[model samples]
Target: MRETVRWRNAVFAVFFAMGFGFASLAARFPTARDALDISVDQLGLALLGISIGSIAGLSTASHVVARLGTRAVVSVGVVVVGVGLAIAGWGVEARSMAVLVVGLVVTGLANGITDVAMNLSGAANERALAKPIMPIFHAFFSFGTVAGAGFGALGEATGLGMGPQMTIVLVAIGALSVVVRPRLVEQPIQPEDHVGFRERLSVWTDARTWLIGGLVLGMALTEGSANDWLALLMVDGHDFDPVGAALAFALFLTAMTAGRLAGVPLIERFGRVAMLRATGALAAVGLVLVIVVDDQVVALVGTALWGLGASLGFPIGMSAAADDARMATARVGAVATIGYVAFLAGPPMLGFLGEHLGLRDAMWVVLAFVLLSLATSAVAREPRTASGAPDPAAEVRP
Candidate 1:
């Protein structure tokens, strides 16, 4: 138990750093916009480069993690994120939009690498520990979001150009990540499954895998939506100040952490499917509350519902992806990659919907997908484990 706790602690720290760095970009949005002198549409386009890079990088993640092992991969990922942040910060200081875009692309790639590697490593750790651990790892990300908001305010107070401010933040987090890595159980990754392209294609073609994968896709979309637009909606729709708007996100993530801690036991009592169904309703209810309420307190409660509903998705989905006895790790990787692509696509698509139909209406679209995921989860098949999990039917949520 002690070793297990230490390993998870390391994973948690890395997650915290990644989440903090990523969330800080939310703070920099206005600065990026003003520095480039661009309209909202142009700003969206420029930012789309990051999403594009994430999509491209996710395609190769299994290969990278398989070859490098999670330890080295995670280490490199942290460094990459730090360097990309620095570059973006430098671009902002230089007042070069082109350079900023390039920097964002690099940042996106780094984000993609870390995202997949950490999820895989977290899953591996959960398996080794014989417990549900992924939620705790993600809980740290929530902590980071709260911390990042503060970090950003400090950066702004210093009156440094975004480049210097963000670089300092990223560098500090990256150093912590290095210190954290050695404490974890870093194992040598085996060579990826040798199934050829034609075999891999067959796994993708399966109806059940797609059903499970679709659940992953929807959840990813919902989380990404919260990440990209929760602050904007509070500010634009509710007329919140910057700090107030950020607090909405902080509320949402705090609820997410609390929910995950609660979820461990619930997932133990029920399978991934039952918990997913519950979260879907919870999220939809939250969205409705946010849309209909006038009181700030009520609105914040709605965000908390949204967070609780979203907390367990990736862990559950990854388990489902590996459920097929016949599927290879490569195929599992493919499904996970597809889900992230959905994540990349979701936010901007939501932005477009928000722009055209109002943010509330766009938020409704997310609820629609959440409902679909709930229905799908009811029948989602379990992954066929190579080593029989301590108890597959036990409360393993992820």
Candidate 2:
């Protein structure tokens, strides 16, 4: 039990670090734009590098995990992420779009690999503990983002440039990676016959897997959209300054953190489907509020609601995909790959829309995805037993 606790804490640290690194980059989006002297559409096009690299990484994550184990993959991924951050910072400082795109692509690849490996570790921990803890782990991720964004905001307010800021964050994450390396859980080696590339990839043919992927896709859009563009929208659409915009983005992440922390018990009491439906409604209402209301206070409130609504979908999708433990890695890889379609497509699509309709208006696209997630929430039911029978006892709640 003590060992389990230690492992869990180690995984929490990893998630926190990942969130912190990503949010650090996110908070600097405006700076990158200004430094590079790029238009919104150009920025969006450049951001496509992340999508391209993330898709590549997601496609091959299961095989990497199978070969190298989660701990090693995560360790290597952290170093690569640091290198990517340094490169991105250099690009921003030098005002080179080509360099910036390369940096983003590299960062995205490392991030994608780290994402699957850490979630797999979290799922394994959940099985060992016999409880619903995935949301709590994700809450720590939100906490990390909050810290990173807040730090970036402070730096921005104080006149710190993007280059120095990212360098400091990268160094911190690299050190943390070393500290947490020893505590990660190690999976037993599987025989080659147990999980071939073909068999591992077979989850793609499962209808239920695609439904879960669809649900995750919507949630990913909801969350990824906010991560990539919320602050910029506030600045461009609402006439807010950069610091204020950063604070607003931080508020969204804080609300998300609170929602995830509060969701653990709610999920225990209500089951996954009911809670998802309620949150989906909250997200839709939130986005509507942001679109129609001009008042900053009202918009921020809507942002909070949107954050709460989106908090559960991605993490819950991961938990659902891992329900059949024997096939966890493969299923997780499939779900993550499908879900990332939103990340891959969101930036350029929204940028194009923002070019004509405005950023605020383009966000209405989020509503369509939210509704789709609500429609498919029922597919997230518990996994079946070995006899292929539904196991009520194995459901997320009682």
Candidate 3:
């Protein structure tokens, strides 16, 4: 149990670092845009680098973890994130879009590798505790985003540029990664659990996996759209300055943190499907308010709802994918690959649409996906035991 606790804490640190590193870059979207002097559509094209790299990483993460173990993949991936940030910062400072795209690709690939590894770690820990603690792990992630966004806002308010801000932040993340890597309790794959490559790939063909992936895709777009574009939306759609826009983005992250912190109890009571459906409704209403209300304060409120609604979808979907421990790694990787398409790739597509329709209206596409997730929420239900009772191990309680 003590080792389990340490392992969980290590996973938390990894999640936190990942969030902080990603948001440190995301919070500078406006600055990156201005620095590159690119149009919205052009910026979207550049963001495509992340999508391309993330897809590659997600598709291959299981193999990488199998070869290197979760501990090495996660630790090395975090360090790679720092390297990518350093390059991205230089690119922004140099005002070279090509350099920035290269940096983003590197960052996305590292993020993809770390994401699957950490979630696999978290799910394993959750099983050990015999409680629903995945959301708490994700809450720490949101906490990291809150801190990163706050720092970015402070840096912007103090007239610091993206290059210097990320330089200061990435060093801390790199150090944290070094410290936590050793604390991870690497779970060795048993011979009975070992599967051939073709067998591993078979999870991708499962209909239920795709259905869960669909749900994750919608919620991922909801959360990631904000991560990638909320600040810019505040500037372009709502007429806020860069500093104020960063604050609004911070506000969204804070709400997400709160929701995730509060999620385990709610999930323990209501179950994943109901929670997903309810959150989807809340996210849709929030999007409606943000798009149609035309009030900055209302937009801010809508942003909070959006964050709350998106808080659990990815984590819960991950938990569902890992319900069958024998196939956990493969299924999680497959689902993550599908979900990341929305998280990483969808934003650039939205940027192109925003160039034509306006940023506010492009959100309607996100809303459509949210509804799709809600409609497919049933797929997240826990699998029944052979005796027909809900699996006791899957019951998450205090």
Candidate 4:
């Protein structure tokens, strides 16, 4: 296989591993919590280690990209993530928060760095492919998520303990890390062109970027709210069991995966603006359906609708960042900083709102965000010129 193919495969694998890891923990969380005798508060604090490290890692991505090149950062991230799994697995046996934090931070940094590198690489690859392939590529991450979730059940069915199970998973991931190490290409990222670290840093001041960033923030907030609260909402509010409530989220993930995978060709044919506008409307309607109906079946369908509608959020936004010929790379960096914090902050904010207002009412908070997201996406200009050449403004306007 070509080096680039292998590199892309690694990208897919990295996301796949993250998905699987998330699933294993999700499946085993009840047992793990019982075994450790840890409260929700303690677990939250433990999880903070990963979140903190991911935030720190994301903040420094530009310098990392400039210095190490895309391939090295991603490869290092993959290796570090594997190390994290190793630590996390051992920590599970030892029941040590300190060890677990180490693993969390390692995996967090790995994921953070790899996220930036992969998106940039995928965007670059999109240019080479002369079509929109990025949406489908990001869908691989979604596939990993589903596979990992399902794998947890399979692991239990097979009577594989967490230690051996995690070890086997880590081994597979580590081998792939090494195999793809040499496949990544070191290209001068076009997105970073004509933008200095300082100027790139100044994306905070760009109104257009902020417009888009705010939109991204809203999407993440809504999605995070749903991810953290949906199952609980179904169970606590509607009196469903763990399995029944979980089915809602499972449907959401499936719908989201389908939407994003299908979004690829749609973007290529209709353009980003049209896709965003349409999807944005669909999400809005989905939220409304959930709000209006008290029926569980309809609400679950709303969840799927929300998923499908929200599917295009990040990839399409990144496409917009990379739309500018002169500053695609740097803008992506700037946009990422503003947008990523929402992932960290969203659930907490929604929880606070739910506490004050009501859980259902808190979802209404996301309605505002969703509307803002659609408006912000109006600035998602399509790329016309190939490189940073002075041309008709029409070329940059989508």
Task: Please give the distance, in angstroms, between residue 324's alpha carbon in candidate 2 and its true position after superposition.
Answer: 1.0
* Steric clash count of candidate 2: 0
Q: Worst lDDT window (10 residues) for model 3? A: 187-196
Please give the distance, in angstroms, between residue 372's alpha carbon in candidate 3 and its true position after superposition: 0.7
Q: CA lDDT of each candidate?
A: 0.71, 0.86, 0.86, 0.67
> Candidate 4: deviation at residue 156, Å?
6.5
**Global CA lDDT of candidate 1, please?**
0.71
- When 1 and 4 are scored with lDDT, the better candidate is 1
Poorly placed runs, candidate 1 (over 4 Å):
1-5, 93-95, 154-160, 184-202, 323-328, 379-398
Worst 10 residues of 2 by lDDT: 389-398
Residues 1-398 of candidate 1 have per-residue lDDT tens digits of 78777877888888888878877776556556567776544556666767887877776766676566678878778778877777777887887878877877898887787777776667666766767666777778777876776666556555667777777777787788768778756642232445445665676677766777788888877777787778777876777766677667777777877877776787767767788888878888998888788778888889999988888776677666654423534445676767776556765677677667766677887888787778778644443356855346332323
Write one digit per residue (lDDT tens) for candidate 3, span 214-301: 9999999999899988899999999989989999999889988998988899887888888888888888998998899889999999
Q: Which of the predicted structures, 2 or 4, would earn the higher TM-score when compared with the native? A: 2
Question: 160 in model 2: Cα distance from truth in Å?
Answer: 1.1
Q: Estimate each model's TM-score.
A: 0.87, 0.96, 0.97, 0.82
As a whole number from 0 to 100, the lDDT of residue 215 in candidate 4 is 66
Model 2 agreement with the true structure over 1-398: per-residue lDDT tens digits: 89889998988998888888878888878888888898887888888888888888998999999989998998779878877877887788889999989988999899888788888888777767777788989999999999989987988889887778888888998898888888887752232356888889899999988999999999999999999899899999888799898999999999899989988798878767888898899999999998889989999999999999989998888888877666788888889999998989999999888878988999999889999999999988666689986554454321
Over 1-398, each residue of candidate 4 has an lDDT whose tens digit, in order, gives: 36556655656666666655554544444344445676533544565666666677777877678677887877677667767766766676687778877877787777677777777777666565455666776677667656654555565456556566667767777786677667666743554334567876776678877777776677666565565566556654556555565556566667778988999778767777788878888888888777667888888888889888878887777777766646665667667666766656654565566556655666787788888888777777564557854233422211
